[model samples]
Target: MPLSDLRFLALNAWLKRIFNADVTPTLISGDASFRRYFRVQHKDISYIVMDSPPELIKVLPFVNLANAYSDKGVDVPQVIEVNAEDGFLLLSDLGDIQLLSVLNSDNVYAYYRDALRLLDKVSLVIDNGESGLPLYDAAFVQLELDIFSDWLIKRHLVIELDEKTQNMLKTAFSFLIENVEAQPKVGMHRDYHSRNLMLQNEQLKVIDFQDAVLGPVTYDAVSLLRDCYVRWPDALVEQLMTQHFEQVKSSGQLDRGVSIATYTRWFDLMGLQRHIKAAGIFSRLKYRDDKPAYMADIPLTLEYIRDISARYPELEIFSAWIADSIIPAVEAKL
Candidate 1:
């Protein structure tokens, strides 16, 4: 029998044991990680069964954060059952509608306002004691910056960086890291974007939050406003950014003295760091994991890098290089 079939049989047996009846789960989807999801209906209610391979991904962090965040009034899926020893979890289904699917020019501002309100609750959640979220410190920031250089520029694109080019990237990365250091740290949903947000019962529920971290206050905000998968007009994005700035300030998450100009710089640079990492991650997913669909998103990531980097004097050369060299390479290759 195929390994997948054997795994399915084992999962079925495990579910049967829990319910004391025959239970079959239909595959839903696999995410970017090493986990698979299945939809199971029992007692006329739908639940999501997360099948995270023990050897590949740990189940405890997700369980820990889900409970912690839910207690703080965040609309995360409730955990119903756990078989952590076997890397399986049964959770309340948040449904199939992603926030991205429903967003339009007409409703984006209103919808995004609600999403930003949810962030107030999310920012309140800090440490989870023994299962504390990791710090997104200098080392962490540098490592993520390296992924862009290693995967996208070197490995996938095969661009050998000479001495001057290497120095340019090093300086540019240092400036980005300084921007990260300038902001107040908060609980950040590292992948808090439209795709991971579910729209059920007219509310937004967060998912794919296992990688939450203690990072810049602007991280999640930039992730939502300057999303990788979708682009909003500059005016609309700026409006939402200012809205978030005021919301955070009023809630005391941000200092009242922080100027909108300073906050805008923080948001813009934080987004640049995220897009840099994402472009490389997309390449790594394509080449290492054989998931080529993510490659389609790389161009937008590059465009974001180009546009955002050009806005600052510090990153002018780096931005020019991207526009002059990197974008052409990517265009030709893709």
Candidate 2:
């Protein structure tokens, strides 16, 4: 990964060339995406260079969205320089304040409330009657649900549901989709979890927001509370959810068209769908992608699916089947 032969080196060089800034490059940590990053230091000056290989991930969308957020007074990483052709960017360092490093059981409320306030602010800033991001529409949701079927059911289980079971699944999915479609949509940070929230200067700073989109109002909230990397107690989640519903309502996004009970139901069902999607995605990551850390989260996610499915008697037969047969079998090992 030397500068001369690196795939992203040229792109990094091109961005540096714009500022005529000489840099001493050092590799930096990156998350699960195909993107990588580096820290460059030269003449006592420091900047973070995001090395997103162009062939794998586009730069314009991230750049444009970050710019849009910044323009709206949100604290996004400043784009000091960029080379769109090669997918490299020199950005202002947000500093060493990842939320995970500072979080604990006691301070979750304070930090979460702060995060919620920021979310509310962003919702306010972007409510210009149009969302610039792509909608996580019906098609996108269907694709996600299919991942659950393909990876979790077919691949992991090594079996197919019978016609009766399959029909029940289809019915459950129809309810899920109908519930998802009925909710009000907004610009959502698709992966707004603890790992993505940074703590720059004791204030929560959002990152990994490039995947932001127009999605369900509950998507990010559930992503936060019922995180893949962390789990909170059900009581706490419910309390915070009540607080969040109030915030959303006061923010003027609530139209009387969707009843509160209906919205709550949508939120529950949508969470069930997302948990299933996450379980499948995590399982696939371990089994197919050679990333094994995710396998540990699968059981908890499956349990969530069982718990939620039972909460509604309309889903009793299906939930009972999953809880009694599928989940117990899978839970023993996965």
Candidate 3:
């Protein structure tokens, strides 16, 4: 149903009263998430209307953050009118080009350097106690990891693992949790990557930031560099990572001689957890929503977790178990 319907009758009526035209909702990109965005054109003026089903989605946090960032002069979408009670929000349309699509090996280094500059700007604003987002604490990190057990292991994999393997898995998660929890928490985009970044007017306009949290600083870097949607060569990833480290150091985001080894460990482990979560999420989408396209990407996500986890000698015991037991079993089934 479009916004020109009974559900949005009050909203449409309100939009007419406010914006003064016949507004028709046009669907924009739909993602795995419950929220939806639509374009509304009245005369030559255009806007985006976010339709978030109230029962399944919450809007206040995103609203608050958007306003905060807006106040701080960040180029986020401007909120036009909001029906908080019914989850309808009218916003300024940023445009069609996503930074993800514009990015390539040719000028990736330059573009990413600018992107890091933006992150640095965000850090400065956020660090001044302006943004009051929650941290991805030990509990949350552990909970994210549990998505694998609940969604993948039990739900998708549908296995009754023997006690020994179960214990080993538990130990693996424990190790992962300890390392992940130890990193200094910073404001995370939560979904920071090329896809959420739009190239509007040759500027990187960030979106999909409703779930931002304070997490390991390296998580965003890894998410941006080793994006699940796009792959880059290892050398390029390292180059970008190195550039980020240098810039953050100059920007005072890092202290001199912070353990590079530990940061790499955090990035690798975080990728493992995120990749595992994504694989199961993709499977769930296929089985539950009949969206089989997601299933096509599961193999790459699994390979990422497997390949990265295997390289660490310390992670060998755990990776071998996942490789030999968990993934193979899930792959055969899902």
lDDT of 3 by residue, 154-196 (tens): 7767777788877877777777777767776666777777888
TM-score: the better of candidates 1 and 2: 1
lDDT of 2: 0.76
lDDT score, candidate 1? 0.91
lDDT of 3: 0.74
Could you tell me which residue pairs clash in candidate 3?
none
Span of ten consecutive residues with least summed lDDT in model 1? 124-133
List the lowest-lDDT window of 10 residues for candidate 2.
121-130
Task: For candidate 2, write residues 1-334 as lDDT tens digits.
Answer: 7556766567556756765875566777765666777777766667788888788898777777777666666787888877787788878888767787777889988888777767765553342224566778878878888887888778877767889988888888778887778778877878877888877778767777787777788777777777767777888878777667777877766664656676667668888888878878976876776676877878878788888888988788878887887787667665
Q: Which structure among the candidates has the greatest TM-score?
A: 1
Compared with the true structure, all predictions reach lDDT values of 0.91, 0.76, 0.74
- Runs of candidate 3 with Cα error greater than 4 angstroms are 2-11, 124-131, 286-292, 325-334
Better of 1 and 2 by lDDT: 1
Off by over 4 Å in 1: 1-4, 129-131
Better candidate by lDDT, 2 or 3 = 2
Task: Itemize residue pairs with steric clashes in candidate 1.
Answer: none
TM-score between candidate 2 and the true structure: 0.87
Q: Per-candidate RMSD vs. true structure?
A: 1.3, 3.0, 2.7
